[model samples]
Target: MPQCREVPSRRRVPSTKITVPGPPADLVSRPRLLTVLDGASEAAMVFVGAPAGFGKTVLLAEWARSRDHEAVAWLSADAEDNDDRLFWSAVLEALGGCGRIPDGNPLRLLAVPDAPSTDLAFLGQVADALDELPEPVVLVLDGAQEITSPHPWQGLRALVRHQPAGLCLAVSSR
Candidate 1:
C-alpha cells in the first residue's frame, strides 16, 4: 500500500446514513408470515403497510434472512431521508453493501453539484448501477413512512418500473 502524498479535496456529501435491520435476538419464527412473505421474492415490489407495532419490521427482517442465496440491502429511513437526492443516496449505499456496485462511494456521485435533480433521471442512473450487481438483491426500505413528500417517491416508483431482473424491493411502512 502507498501513502497519499497530499490529502485530496473532499466534496460536499449527503447524509444517506442507513442501517439494515437485523432480526431480534429472541426472534419468533412465524411460518405463516414467512410463507406469505415468500411471495415477494418473485415480485418486483412488496409492501408491508400497517400501523405501528404490527411486526412489520420484524416480518421483513425475517424475510430478508430466510434465504441464503439472495443478497439483501437494508435502508432504515429517517425524517431527513425525504429528499430525492438523500433518499437515493442512502439507497445506493445500502445496495452497495452486497459487495457489488464496485468500490466507489455513491454519495460522492450523488452530491456532485452538476448532477441531475429530477428524480426519474437521477434515480434511473441509480437503478442502472444497481442492475450491475453480481447477484440479485432484495432491498428493504424500513420506516418508509418517514418520507412525507410525494416528490421523492416518484423515484421509488421509477425504480420498481425499471427494476432489473436481479433486484426486488420490500418496503415496510406505517
Candidate 2:
C-alpha cells in the first residue's frame, strides 16, 4: 500500500477561514435576499456567483449569522487550498469542528493529520452519514473561484451528486 503523507499543520489555517465572519460594518441589509436564502434552506446546494465587488461575501456572512451558529460550517477557500487533499482536509475540518456533528462521527476519520487520500467512496460515505443526521447543517464555501484545479472539483461534484437531505451546501464564486 502506498503510504499516505502526513498533512502539514505548520501553516495554521486562519480562524476566519473556518469561522463565520460577521457582516461588514457598512453592510446594507437585504431582506429580500435574506428571504430567498431562508427559502433555500431545504435545497441541496445554494450557489452565489458574480463578479468581484458584488458583495457576495457580505450577503453570505449576513445570511449565515441569521441562522443558528451551530448549524453552519464555514470555509473560505483560497489559492493555497487548490489541492485535492488540502481542500478536502479543510472541508472535513470545517464540518467536523462545527458543533453540529456529534463526537466520533465517521466524518472525523478524514479530518485527522495522517488520514488517507479522500476519494469518491469516502465522500459517498460522508453523504450517507449526513443523511442520517437528525438536523440540518449548512456548509458555506466562500471564494470557491480560487480553486482552479479540477481534481478537488471532481470530488465536490461527487459529493453534490450524492448530497444528503441534512447537508445543505452553499457556495460563493466569482
Candidate 3:
C-alpha cells in the first residue's frame, strides 16, 4: 500500500486557501439557485461567473456546505497561486483534505515538492485515481480568476478532459 505523503512545505500555503468559507452571517437561502446547482451536479464542470458583490462566493459556499454525501474540496485562489507549483500544490492539499480520496492515492504524489506541476501524464494519473472514487467529490475553485498562469491552466485542462463521473469541477470567477 502506498503511504500517505505529507503536503509540500516549500511554499507556505495559507490555511484559509484550503479552508471552505462558511456562508456569510447575513446569508439568505437561495433555494432556486441551490436547486439549479443541484440539478447540474452531473456536469463535469460548472462555471459561476458574475461581477464582484454578486454573492458568487456565498452561493458556492452554501452549495458546498449542503452536500451530505458528496465531498467538497474548496480552494479560494489568490494572486500567489499564479505560480504553477503553488497553484497545483494548493489544489492537491485541498483535495487531500476532502476526506474522499482513498489512502495511497496517486493524487497525493502531486503534493511532493519535486513533483512536476505541468506534467500532463502525471495529471492523467491523478484523474485516474479520482475516476475510481467510490463517492463523488466536488472541487470548487472560488476566485479562479486569480490563476493567470497558462501552465496551471494546461494542467487543469488535462484534468477536465479526463474527468470521471466521480469528480465534478466547480469554479466561480468575476
TM-score of every model?
0.75, 0.86, 0.87
lDDT of 2 by residue, 1-83 (tens): 99997644423466768988876778799999999998997999999999999999888989989888888889999997876
- Cα-based lDDT at residue 132, candidate 2: 71
Which candidate achieves the best lDDT against the true structure? 3
- Report the CA-based lDDT of candidate 3 relative to the real structure: 0.81
Candidate 1 local lDDT, 1-174, one digit each (tens): 998665222232243344445677987878887888786676888888999998888888777777652377777787876665566656765665554445663422443122223535566666676666566678888888998877557667776888776678888899
Model number with the top TM-score: 3
In angstroms, how far off is 81's CA in candidate 2? 1.7
lDDT of 1: 0.67
lDDT of 2: 0.79
* lDDT, candidate 3, at 105: 71
Error of 3 at 20 (Å): 1.1
Model 3, residue 145: what's the lDDT?
Answer: 90
Model 1, residue pairs in steric clash: none
Where in model 3 is the C-alpha error above 4 Å?
Answer: 1-10, 112-117
lDDT of 3 by residue, 76-143 (tens): 99888878778877887888878888778766545434444566566776788788888878999999
